[model samples]
Target: MYDPAYGATDADLITFMGEEVREESAALGRRWFLVAELAGRRFPEMVGRQMYCADSISSVAAEISPVLNISHSRAVWQVETAITLRDRHPQVFKRLCRGLIDYRMVSMIVARTDNVADDVMVELDEAMAGRVEKWMKLSKNKLRDRIDLFIAEFDPAAVRVPPDADKHRYIDIDPGDTAGTAFVSGRLHAEDGAALDQRLDALADTVCSNDPRTKSQRRADACGPLARGEATLACQCGLDDCPARANRAAANAAVIHVLAEQGTIAGTSDKPGYLPGFGVLPAQSVRNLLPAAQTKPVTVPTADTAAQTGYRPNATLTEFLRWRDLTCRWPGCDKPVQRCDIDHTVPWPYGPTHPSNTKHYCRIHHITKTFNTGAGGFTDEQLPDGTIVLTAPTGHTYRSQAHGASMFPALRQPTGTVETTPLPPESPDRIAMMPRRRQTREQDRRERIATERRKRTEIITEQQRQHQAWLAATYEPPPF
Candidate 1:
């Protein structure tokens, strides 16, 4: 059914690939147009709405999710891109439709200008559209820098600000596919990560050179003693008086949390135990953790214990909710429960602070609900069994059940019913009372961009001075 490319020369193949890419770009542009149309149809009155704000909610992504077989979050991003290109960057969209610019370039331009004000966006669109097609060979970082340069020149206040890296630092451990092993990973501050790497090397070297383990194996093993705060790793050469062995004071043990059934810990049952961030542990692995484990009994919530008269739940209730929900209760959100806030499904004053009326929401979603609830926003309801029903503004409902319910059936037990009073009429002017930054977004962006540009200028000036000094040191006058 297809012609073979085996006989084609390398040059012919290259030309064919280039043509295919152009055709694909044009097709993707048409697809984006359809996506924009779908979003419009779903929310015809979205003209004045802020589609990309934290408080904004859209069900168009949910509709697209099933059709595209992609995650809701990915679909949401696609919708945003489509709308941005079609409405905010008409000239860029035209270039895209003509296959002069690829989708990747379009995506980058869209993301870079996300915080741009409407008045500035029109100019950015026109400027970028005329130049981006010529940037097909630029590396990703180079392209990003170029886009930022344009933004900095046109509207310094609209340049995208870098996030605080420290706030986003994280560590993750995942169970390996192979039995009885786990993968450890993390992001750390540059100096800290480098120090850790050096420490691991030092610890690994403490073992005798004659030790049979490979360098990498020794380094991996060194992590255990390092985590326990040990100063040195014991030599394994089996010499009676090894020089590397030292009689040192014992360091404090590292603490970790592991959840398991009594039977599993006692070796009477083979049921796998759950490790919060890392997935299921084999029965043997659970038993292995018992040696250094400090067991904490998690009490199951009963009707009486689950209901709270005050706004805050007791520690017991809090623990129960964390174990039950496992992650943020917002549909498709996977933020761990440890990092989430226990929010009342129905506002506290109108409803009792009971398990049945509360669920986990990460900080972002918590604020999203706080500012975007009422006649034109999302609604949240909870069933007695810790199941949440979230209804979007477009009237599409998404259901999320407690993730831990499958592991612990007791979590599904109903808490006592609480009567909820009708909420007070929402003020039409409430939008005006929403929180505002001390400095406006534009002001903040401007300051950040100015600081960045100043630093770059300083660096360039220093480099030029260094170059002039080097040339002066090497100078020799020509003899007449």
Candidate 2:
């Protein structure tokens, strides 16, 4: 162990040892991606799979890899830095990189929807049925849920997904020639005037050319003529039958006229009536804001058809009920359609309405069902396998399962007790691998010297005092 001749100081020994360990750790990190891919499971699933592998040891980093994977595993260089000794200590660096790889893989599949192929969808009849075989096997529903969320966030408009063109983003109403054009004329305030003008410019540009920048980007760059001071407002598209132009214009005029007469600018318009000050309504919004008024049917009041019904005899009870359901049927939401509300798939207006459109929800999900802008506002459709498909406003769709994807199992009985799994223990090896305490060499030397001097001084002072006391006491005793 005495290696002075070799010039090996303790520092040298530690540095050499650290270098070796760091090299080995780096090498392991390099192979992590390949290891994750060969394992059919995603990066998150790898932690469980690796548990059974004899080569697998408990790693703090592996457990958190999914998060790190998305953040750090974007590029090779980033992965190296994330896992290298220069950044993280050798062992710790390796584990962190492992976690990153796992997360990266999971996020990719979820973001892309690697499952639910074109052929698979066609064979399954409806989109939701297709994902059943592919997605059901994953023990954790969180992964699938995350996949759906990712699709919702990143691809909500369903832009450029292959095989199904409808899955991609396209103009809702194609901008064609405006034959049956409608108009909304009124005084627009500063903010409203700016926004409307911007929209008009964007629409005009789109009409001129099919391609334009993104909506948000265009909005940001939009600087159009102000309409705050009274101005004529008219929108014309290339299409002769532009539903938005015709319907919205008609609705707006009716709404404005009514509001003007009443000397009030604000009111919800569900019917084809005019407000005094407000302009025409958008047709898409007409049913929710104002319902048409009609003469009540003559019917003898009966106990069954009580006042609670709010129905008049000879009244279109069917239409009235449809209107109620068409509103935010979710408890407590009164958001008009312009602000955005999910339409129930089943029509309540007609007899034996479709359940899909009847149960509408607004921006805030009611927490009863997964109501969202994704999957096209969460409509239910029967798949070929008789499974119900819940499509978000985004294009991604999933089947309602007997059991949920996470450890929080699906309800057995409505009254069953909910349980939560305990978190696992942390790895000691992982703890050991973190960067060591960073005391300075000078501070350490000073502390050691101070301690040594204090000990030596105490020894010397005790010896001197004892010698002096003994000399004085011995002479006195001899004399006596």
Model number with the top lDDT: 1
Instruction: Please write out the lDDT profile of model 1 over residues 1-480, one tens digit for every residue.
Output: 123456777777787888888989999899889889877775654433342334222456644553464545677788878988988999999888888889779889988886666788888889988899888789999999999999878866566656667878988877677655678988899999999999999888887667778889889888878998987776677887776776433498776666677888888998887777666778898897786678888777677667678899888888888888888877777678888899998898798888899889876567666666776577888988888887776577787888876676777788777789999888876554554446543356567656755555666578789999999999999999
lDDT for residue 242 in candidate 2, whole number 0-100? 48
lDDT of 1: 0.76
Give, for candidate 1, the lowest lDDT window spanning 10 residues: 48-57
In model 1, the Cα lDDT at residue 436 comes to 43
lDDT of 2 by residue, 1-480 (tens): 436579988888887776665465445455554444322233352242222211111122222222233211133233333322222133322343443223333333423432323233232223332233355245555545645554334333221123433334232322123321232334545576677766656443432222245555333333211222212222234456544344222222221212111111234322232221232333333333334322232222222331221112123323322232323432223333334343433322321222211233433332223312222134454322112355443344554321110111211112111122432433434323333224433345456545544554565578789999998888654464
Off by over 4 Å in 2: 1-105, 110-169, 172-315, 327-480
Q: Give me candidate 1's TM-score against the actual structure.
A: 0.67
Per-prediction TM-score: 0.67, 0.19
